[model samples]
Target chain A: MKVNYFISDIFYVCLRDLKHYLKQRVRIMATLIQPIIWLVLIGNLMSGLTANPLTLKFLDAPSYLDFMAPGVMVMTTLFTGLFAGVRVVWDRRLEILQKMLSTPLSRTAIPLGKIAAAVVQGNIQVIIVLLTALMLGVTFKTGLAGIMVILIFISLFCSIMASISIALSVNIRNMETFFALMNFITMPLMLTSKAMFPVEAMPGWLKFIAEWNPISYAVIPLRTLVTKGWDWTVIWQSLIILCFFALCFLAGAVFFFKRARA
Target chain B: MKNIIEVKSLSKIFPGKITAVNKISFSVKQGEIFGFLGPNGAGKSTTIMMLTTLHLPSSGTAFVSGYEIKKSPRSVRMQFGYVSQDLAVDDRLTGYENLFLQAKYYHIPNQTARERIKILLNLVELEKRAKDLVETYSGGMRKRLDIACGLIHRPKILFLDEPTLGLDIHTRRQIWQYITDLREKQGITIFLTTHYMDEADSLCDRIAIIDHGVIKVLGTPQELKSRLGGDIITLDIALTHVAKIPRLIKLLKTLTNIKQIKTAKTKITIVTLHAESMMADILKIIQKNSIPLEMVMLKTPSLDDVFLNFTGRSLRDEAGNREQAHKARRMLRRIRS
Candidate 1:
């Protein structure tokens, strides 16, 4: 809540992590390769398969690639977030996290700032994936604002994940334990979300689970933005859920964080 | 005199029924050096977490630089620099970048940030390694960068939690020297915690000894040791003569000049209230007792002795078995998910 300190810590979070990431250019490039492969090889192979089945006459014409695009985008966000939380874990181990925590930076700034950096990184990845998708014949459906739409998707998912990451990072006091729990925590959550498959394709319970998953909201407006044209109803409803998750996650993270000191 | 840091009845408890810190009280005078001395898990780190506004305490309150830790943490953090034991410095970044990031955390203007980073680099003796990735540097070099990062903001007070830990003895000396020099030159109030008695003895003006969530003692190095009211005398009797120690201790305590006596199997140590005349008297008793000693020495009590005397355990012992550290990480992942 302290303006000067929070304002500065946000920049602190971005620049330090960015510089660290920059030095590992090879790793960054490697991480980007996974999503690029999905955009190219998978999009191409699955586009045909997804086309007819993904579209129903009542739902309007939706390309298989288009239907899969948002899912993939959110998947990128999800995967990117998976390790981002670990960055905090790494910070905890190396004592770097202690240095950051001790400074004049806000508790809110630490997580939000890192999340902001992830958003920027996520935006970059989304752009590359979008470009590759475009080359593979995926359309944006909406013109000129493709970049803007990509940024929005990045913010929605990054904010949600960043909040979750910080909350856990503070709580998790060690590294090996974090590794052991990853299967239980991150893997199941990612699989249950509607990232790679349609909600209808899922069984009843799973469909219900997907609907409840926050990532489902991330994909709703995102899929509409990429395919089947933009509809305010789906767009607005998706925005509401995403926003609710963002606020809820952040509030919850801060609250627990406050208790941790106590 | 203004107390730059004020803590009263501060306590923290983990949900798992572990008392990390009990109600403790202390304060730091502006520009003064205050040491928080404790073995690992004595809650030194936990206390620092609360002071720096990183972890919110479950009970009690603290004020730093005139701001309450609970009510105005952001403002409190702004006025201080907190260097931690966790080695927060990123290995990929050069020394300068680390400080630049710290400057950003303090919200320094860009023009000033550049100059401040340069100044801090020189202070930690990393001016030469300022551009190298920390990953390439030795442990000592990385530690220096971490110190430089903490000082970039020109904070009036600095909180250093075990700054010299994990360093070679020589490197520890260098850092100790650097901190003393900085304190004298800039008049920065330094708040530090350490398991190293020599670190507290050499660097701190006063210290608070904590163990098992309690502050057992608080005084200057000289004051704390002096409070025992004697010169510490150690007699290294042979292991075979271990039984002779108890009788010797009884005999030694009977000396008019000696105040307290204790025995540790093969070694008999005594504290003499009248230090000047007591050694000769003590030497006479060993001769009379026919205790052939391997070595005999007398000096002020080190921090280790103070700790062992108080806690009945060594700090190094608690540092063992880090498997639970990994378990803590798993719990972290679960909570996050």
Candidate 2:
């Protein structure tokens, strides 16, 4: 019975967030439009860079769109997951969080539910990105199984990003400050990782940073599944790393949420 | 009736060593409308937070419906409904949805939650707007919905931290009606904190006047007023004449009919046996001293007088400043959002 309540608490929290997300028509429009712009414009624009035989051989993909689609899907996830904490900040400002805290619901349920909502949203955007890529003539090498793997990668990556966002938001009360911090962190993470380019093409120092970047672990597996078939060696290494980071950040998020103050 | 809430020297000192709620002890009787009356920053909300299990006490503890707040917060939380000072209802959700979400927080089953939401929407008179998003709700309607959300679980006690702080007078009175009905109809004990004197005097069965993190006095409205025991002559002086308050009090001290004199801001309250008979002498002294009196009125002792007599300041004066600040902050938040 106790476990039942805990699970229901998480469900309701996630449900409320989804309800809010669905109500904002403009936000939904923006979410759909953003990934399409990146895929159609940036994907085509960067395709020229990989047009050379030498570059194509190094890229090991039929087209630039195939290599970049997975990166763009993870990028969308990155943006959504990082901003998930904005809701927590707003809830704190409005005292909705305090009201929830006063309830009998477990504190861990709050952040876990928010992470769940972000993962769901991340998957929705991933699907949209994938369909757009498919419409743009990008084919997956691993077929249906690869698509499922990509969804799992996005969910794990989103949970990691969202957990960090929420953990920071629990301490930082101001929305402006949270926005500044998210921007500072997101730009470095997105550009330094192999999201938009091949890490092999990056300079020595940048490649080192990209290899160490957690986001690359997520994007690498996704790119491999899309461009090169299911290579278990590469997939397993990145998957384990993603799972470890997800676990650590989720534990941190729950810890901060339990101590959240109005 | 037994005590529904028992706070024993509950104190909260923030990290900076700022004591928000000092060692204050009070017991609220079951099925009673108990008011925590104080100005802003007087530990009213802190006490409520501690009782609601949102903030851990630094040194002492409290119990709600026999569950200790610190040791068993979930059990304590299960017993009370909390309506915070800010509007905590989700604007994106319909009124029904808001109440349903609250019911889910308490683990109320869907079937029971729907039934409770229907009854609550009707009770709060939001039946017409039940399906509309709360963003469309007026200030009063949103507050009513907030109160209904608090009641969805049908907890034994309800904690309202300034439930009507920003609403207009009409809406404030309407909320008061709902609060009274909750106690009378459902026998739910209510613990509310407010800076409004009229709200406390009219609605609360018992009032605890707190100031600077301490409870100065606690009693029923009548008991507090009768403790002052006589008529009161209040003199409101202009801001320019604030310095003259000392002379006015000194002069009024000479009158045999006047028992005690208190000065808060620019208002001088004189406790006397017969205010009407003492009026002539008071006016003569004011006129001679050229104190520039703005207004004068003589009436029986009220909760305002009781507050002034204990805290040496008028509740209305502090509340007026706080109300302005509260409204400004709310306006800024609305514009920014």
Q: Native contacts recovered by candidate 2, as a share?
A: 0.92
RMSD of 1: 6.5
- C-alpha lDDT of candidate 2 relative to the true structure: 0.88
- Write the residue-wise lDDT of candidate 2 on A136-233 in tens digits: 98988899988998898899999999999999898776789999999999999999998887777889999999988988889888989998898999
RMSD to the true structure for each prediction, in A, is 6.5, 7.3
Q: List DockQ for all candidates.
A: 0.46, 0.47
Candidate with maximal lDDT: 2
Writing each residue's lDDT as its tens digit, candidate 1 over A1-262 gives: 4576667777778766666666777878876687678766776676655556434432333556666777777777776664556677777667676676666567667666677777777777777777777777777888558458656867777778766766776666667766676656666776787766766667889888887887777877777777756677887777777878888987876766545531
Candidate 2 - CAPRI tier? acceptable
TM-score of chain A of each: 0.87, 0.97
TM-score of chain B of each: 0.78, 0.78
